[model samples]
Target: MPRALAARWYSDHDQYQNERRVIWGSEWLMFGVTAELSRPGHYVADEIAGYPLLVVVDPQGELRGFHNVCPHRAGVIQWPGCGQTGNLVCRYHGWAFSWDGSLKSARDFGDSPTPDDHSLRPIRVETWGPLVFVNLDENAPALASTLGSLDTAVRQHAFTDFAYGRRLVRTLECNWKTYVDNYLEGYHVPLLHPLLNSAVDMKTYSVEVPDDTYCIHRAGQVEGSASAGVWVFRYPNLAINVYSDGMNVERIVPLSSTRTAVVYDYFAQDVSEEKIQSMVEMSNITLDEDQTIAELVQRNLDAGVYEAGPLSPRHENALAWFQGRIRQSTGAR
Candidate 1:
């Protein structure tokens, strides 16, 4: 990787603003919110970047999001990942918050009878494809506009009909970009993926950047090879891997300069327990292969041994295209 690109990974301002513009300022971020949240007060705790969040579907069937913190003393509102609660009550001061993050009640503390100034901060939220997304930027564009052509692709491909099947979160020793770059191309599949090679036809693989913010890779069988299904990317850092019977949506979340968290979600059309488990296993094998290469690349970048490498037009236009988009998005030359 060129130091200019790698510098984006290591620079404090670049990293901070990247998270601000891409993650917090962008459209829907994948979190959980299926029929599982049908109950009145059921809620789930989620984290983005370093901000913790609380999402709930209240009695009126309306979805709401909060900062997951009590404004009174800056205490955590929900400690557990999720459960039913009559109302959101701060454990520290007994202040209560409504489903919409409005202050509902408060215990005696001082002459301030009203808690109007104390409601939990609200976040913009939207639901699509059975997954909930939050936007920390209150005035950001609607999820529909931010997604652009991706909305058509997901719908036309019938991707939303699949149900949630499995999830995996793993920590890796690499900058998040390393993982994104590794995934942008199938050039290494012949050497890195053996079991996958048995299923995926490497020669027939090709990538399409439908728009500046979106890309998809065809993972079907090569003319003389065999693969499973098509893999897709929706810009910045979301991977949509479509399998024969299901799909996996993986997102890259950076935790630090050399650390990242990979959130993998698997979904299947049919809801059989056995089928779900098998899907998870197959996805894991593919991920392990990618992780091995990503870590090596990250190490080399850290050692300052590589600056920029040439793009192989034959096998890597997809990867190069992604780099170009990053340059445009971040204003890099």
Candidate 2:
């Protein structure tokens, strides 16, 4: 896919369209890690493509992803978030399911007649490092294969060893793609993020698109200092931003055509608690700036002020590449 075509597609709405039908539909979508669910029967609920989802760890410590809907009465098996429960019970009919999504008990059904096809639909589960991903399409590629060159980048960056520092969610008044576009380029830093401009060297910043699956951007810093930072944009949705002391990674999940909910996690390698607090403060400030600019862009785009925008070869090539990949995935070009 050419950069021009890619940029055009992203601008035209390929991000939301493709994600719902393609990325989240067939490919592996990351949920947290194996450690999050802790005990057997503990479950976390999330949604993708508007379908309710349940992630759980069994007695054997294996993690599984299941449709949160009960097959019997189509009632939701869990709430819209994570929780620990001994058994998944449908609130409507009292159908119970096991940790692995098998039907455990049906409250009201004849002995001869099946209460319902009560089993929960299973989503393919895969684990890498501490992260867990589920493929709604059963035959989709493994998370590692889909990761492409990012597997190496993730390992080299040692994100697996970084402990979770904080998790934050912000609902932004913008299209999800709008926020992603803002993130993919540094063109807005000097203008929208005065604080970030002081922290990151704008002139020395460079983005590397090793393949269609991953894009990495390096932030320039002082020599012989541990101030180097990198941001990895994993194809489709995840953003892995690693700093010297800590790291911040986020996934952009669209709630609607014009609204996005960003799930962010902050991690620290060996930083002190005070430093982590400070990093969190700085991160929030940066995110606030980004959300502000992104919202404005969304408003302008919605108003049709511009049909499309050009990506500068010098500054916006990475965003151009990202847009190109999106076009390729969705057959936009």
Candidate 3:
């Protein structure tokens, strides 16, 4: 019989810190979509696992990732969110960095020998289909190895050709793991997401753990449904949900031990304003239902009353696999 993770795993501060190093620090995390940085000078800046990252399209038309902090005073060089810029200039001291992360200039430091060493620290970055992923661990396996057959599985849908649609960011009052655990299984769908259950045939839902790095959730189609949809959850915190109308890539970022920020970037083949609005409304409704239960689960886990529970073998195998991965990654026996 599969078992639920200990309550402490969800609420402990030290454990959360360990997770930052063991899991988030080493995993290949999805940063954004390639379309976001389609042109030279386009950039996206954000924080993941407390580390600020900057991804940009260089003048040479290559995607690059950096630490986003100025090497001089460690001040943030780029502002948060996406924008277009010819060069990244540190507002604190006017230290300038080229698109490729080379130190272009240092204000008032005339040809200083140390300027050469002040270039932005590079982070490992790779693209899979339309998604952009970054890794802090320079030695980590290639993104393709981590993704396994996920690309082939969704290739027929031409996911890579999809255009950027919209994005929604929501801050949830729950541990990041709580949100991830809730996402890995369909056990709670009939009870937690009635609308979603009605849209997809839940009776035929199945989970496949292709490898330790990710899981694919396949559900049968309902009559006249646009598409069966493909859902992939990369270990730790990235979710790729693909529907006929569009795809939603969700990144679950930890704000604190008990708070998480969920960022969803929507992409689609045909991005009309009407389609974007409709997708937003439908996604909001589904996300509202999920947030409610995830927050409730976090509250109960903190109450000190529920230590653990047995997993439903038929419905929660994926959840068990996810918790096991956490244990394996964090060495939390």
The sequence of per-residue lDDT tens digits that candidate 1 reaches over residues 245-305 is: 6777787776665787988877889868998887888678888888888887777776766
Scored against the true structure, residue 89 in model 1 reaches a CA lDDT of 87
Which scores better on lDDT, 1 or 3? Answer: 3
lDDT of each: 0.72, 0.73, 0.85
| Per-residue alpha-carbon lDDT of candidate 2 for residues 1-333, written as tens digits (9 for 90 to 100) | 223342233344545666677766776666665567767877888875476788887778777788887787678878887777666788788887776667778786657234335578988888877667777887887777777778888777777788766678899888666787778887777888776777667888878788877778877765544346678887666888776667877877777667778888778875577877877787888898888888887777767445565678877878788766556667765
Give me the overall lDDT of model 1.
Answer: 0.72
TM-score-best of 1 and 3: 3
- Score every model by TM-score: 0.87, 0.89, 0.93
Misplaced by over 4 Å in model 2 are 1-18, 111-116, 223-227, 270-273, 331-333
Q: Which residue pairs overlap in candidate 3's backbone?
A: none
In candidate 1, the residue pairs with backbone N, CA or C atoms under 3 Å apart (3 or more residues apart, or in different chains) clash, namely 1-307, 2-307, 199-226, 199-227, 200-226, 200-227, 201-222, 201-226, 201-227
lDDT of 2: 0.73
**Cα RMSD for candidates in order:** 3.0, 3.0, 1.9
Error of 1 at 84 (Å): 2.1
Sequence-dependent TM-score of model 1: 0.87
Off by over 4 Å in 3: 98-104, 109-113
Best by TM-score: 3
